[model samples]
Target: MKDVYLFSGFLGSGKTSMLTNVIKQLKERNLKPAVIMNELGKLPFDSQTVEEDIPLKEMLEGCICCSGSEKTEAQIQTLLLNEDFDVLIIETTGAAHPVEALDAVYSPLFADQLNIKGIVTVADSKLWLERESLTPQVRSLFLEQIRHAHLLLANKMDLLSESEQAKVIFEMQGINSHAFILQTTNGQVSYKLLENLQATSRISKDDIHSAKIGKHLHLSSLLIEFNKSYTQQQIEDWIKTLPSTVYRIKGYIPVEGVKNPMLFQYAYGLVQWLPEYIKMPAKVVLIGENVDEVKVIDE
Candidate 1:
């Protein structure tokens, strides 16, 4: 059976990063995999970021809603027919509703060719708490994404306080208690996501135990692209102005201070600065949850 993994999460929840890491891990183990990413923005940065070329494709335009599914399935079938790989990963857009995205491929058209290996969801610790801000439609999608997954990666674990992290975990576990839960930073937990099918989901009755997503902050995530150079300290000091409610932040930022774009994280008053960019411009995304903060801060 071909393992088809769907990396589902709200926008900016480390889905693309995790998908890339999973591909790399598969390569190290001598397995070839194909990637299909749905991008909300104009750029195809995620497909380009994979370490070594294997077969990468992108479905860009809109979120993977039912309207877009028919068109996307045509692409997926093309990839499966043209490329021979052990696994296929579909990374959804930040605004995507996971259940709808799943329905797109899980349709009778493609379901026979792809075995549903797992649905791995990467959630930002900071953003997951502000579930209240989402419109009823999007919020329904968010919880449905969690409820349907076989695995849940509670990413950006480093951002939350111990108590806060525990509380979110308790809540998530309440959604799909049967799904295996793993905590990660910057989508680095490839081991937990791939090549491990320990068992099947328990299908507990509580998977749909409704919880109110009230009073949560509405978030607008932005991927800031820099055509000009920026100093490292400039970014450091700028991040200080962001509120503590920031759920998760990641991506490459080229520093005037250094050659590589430093990976930044602003959560729970902890800022993680990565070594340097191995590649292009300082592209970083800021996702503020339940934060009455700025829309997209650009340099």
Candidate 2:
């Protein structure tokens, strides 16, 4: 089983940078690592910032939950079989729910290929408190994700004053005493944390809040699938993913003539594309529940 680490954070919370730094540390040990980047430019602006490229694959503009769809486990199985890396790093979008991704991977299909090393949640210390309530319930979602993490990386502390950093740390740890909270700048968290850390103590079933349907936990995902064709440019211009009721949006986009499928991922207004391969069928899958999915799909 490979060590699978999930990096989740709120919009602009520096999740990408934190993930990149961790991958760098892994590479330094001469450990072959595989990275499954959710969206091209959603967080931390892609992997170009980090020099590790031997086994990098971008989901291109959409998240794993949205991009993988019916083929979710298949994609993961593919990653495990094809990539020679010892560790798999996944960077989720700011709007993504850690529970949803966890739910996806907990499936029996990936039973042999993967093991949950732990979850690392990155938070932008400077904006966390302020954005906690300003944007679409992101603060709540962000906190929930952190609550589930084995390691909580409080990133962008350099943007905060020393005292402010302390306060943020205090508030974060207060949520989950079990979480290994670390104050960091530019996502420079150490790999030792992962190596040295043991797995989380299994909580009594009641200890962890029961994930409810209407609650943050996703009982089901509503998909808006478009059978028609679309160009990469068209999908980029039309799609928007965020932290509102619409948690995240992404899917396979086929630019008619392009050989490879063009993926589209959007979160909190940070839109990114492959800007290279353009594929077809353009089957776009949008994941959202209740009224939000309707708003995007019915339109």
Candidate 3:
């Protein structure tokens, strides 16, 4: 039976980084790996991180747990039929609920061919500490992700002090006593550990069937395309004007003086700018609560 791992995390909690590390480790062990990446935006920005050689399927514009379930099953069936791989890793959209995602994967069409593993959630240590600052709906979603993880990663430990780290661990342990929690930086963890790990418990087929599948959160995404180059400072100024409801902003932006569009990412009020050697679409996807009403490009 093929092994499967589901990656769950909040936006910018470092799921993609962990995925990259896992893929590298899998290759090192001579295990073939395949990925199904789900994104809230129409553009598959995160899928670019997966190497061209790896078999990848992209599910965009919706969460796999709800509206995307049928597509999720179809993608899995396609991969299973056409690809030769030992393990499949599904990276759910940040807004996805753990239970619903598992339910979608438990489809009978391909259930017999797979050995289902547990959810591997990546939690932002700092975000957990400051979760109260988020909206009620978002806070609940974040905690649900942590509460359901079997192999939980308390990521971004470098940003926390000794005392803060202790608190983060204490809180995570309180929420999920069964998970094997790891304190990591840049989502780093040992693949050997993952190979031997199993989910604390499986959500039975009955539970999956009984569970509701619909809009799980108030979060939404708005895609913004840039027709003209803007300075980094201009972009930062616009970000400052955004309300606290805005959680994540990511995509390629055309910098005034740069030869190639730079990758811009904003999460939990922190901004990062990385230079991209190759030119990509000059657009940004904003994900947050009621983000569609947000104004853009005028700043």
Candidate 4:
């Protein structure tokens, strides 16, 4: 039976980071893995961050839970038919609701082909503490993501004090007593976290919290396509001056004097740039709420 794993979390909650580590561990055990990354933009950055040459499918400009349901089914079919993989990992966008995403996985079409392993949710400690500051719609979506998880991964533990981390775990348990809670730093966790996944059982919408009626989330993306290269100092200066509303900024940027394009990721005021060679065009995707596209372009 092919195992299907779902990684659900909020934006910048470290789901992608955790998935990378998990994929590496799975490979060491001789398991082939395929990935499906859902995004709200035309160009994707998280999928490009994955390591180890696994087959990847991008479901862009929509969440799989709602608008991308058909696309999700079709992609699963294509992967199952065209690829030889032992496990499949679906990383939903931060705004995704686990209830609806699981509904797509439990569809009758994939009942025989795919087995529901577990829904792992990654929560940012700092974000959780400041959730009240977020808009009601986004807050509800974030809560629902955590409420329906089978494994709640409390990521970014290093950023918090021991007592703070403990309190976060306590609060998560209050929200989801059934889910197994684990603390992680930089998305590193033991491979045992994926073990003993309850295969047959499925969670329904009613099983989740009493979320808002409709799946409404105010998310905007500033997609920028560029061909020219820039200096390292220029890029770093721009990142420092990013707007407070910007939730994520990722792109493939060519350096002025470097041979390869640099992969850029900035979120939660933390910045990362790694040099990598990709055949795809250089582009930047900025996701945030009520962000000014013109201002983003200026940066």
Most TM-score-accurate candidate: 3
Model 1 lDDT tens row, 92-133: 886776545655554333443556555677877787788888
lDDT of 3 by residue, 95-171 (tens): 99886786567553455467666689999999999999999999999988988776899999999999999999999
| Candidate 4: pairs in clash | none
Q: Is candidate 2 or candidate 3 better by TM-score?
A: 3
Per-candidate local distance difference test: 0.65, 0.60, 0.80, 0.72
Q: State the lDDT of candidate 4 residue by residue for 31-127, as single tens digits.
A: 9999999988898889887764788999888889755777898899898889999999999888787756765554444554666666888999888
TM-score order, best first, reads 3, 4, 1, 2
Q: Pick the candidate with the highest lDDT.
A: 3
| Model 4 error, position 188 (Å) | 1.4
Name the 10 consecutive residues with the lowest summed lDDT in model 4.
208-217
Model 4 misplacement above 4 A: 202-299
Give the TM-scores of the predictions, in the order they appear. 0.61, 0.61, 0.67, 0.66
User: Residue 248: error of model 3 in Å?
Assistant: 30
Q: In angstroms, how far off is 228's CA in candidate 2?
A: 45
* Residue pairs with clashing backbones, model 1: 11-94, 126-247, 132-213, 217-290, 230-256, 253-261, 253-282, 254-282, 260-277, 261-277
Clashes of each: 10, 7, 0, 0
* Model 4 residue-pair collision total: 0
lDDT of 2 by residue, 147-220 (tens): 76768888887788878888888988887677788888777887888875433111112121222222221212
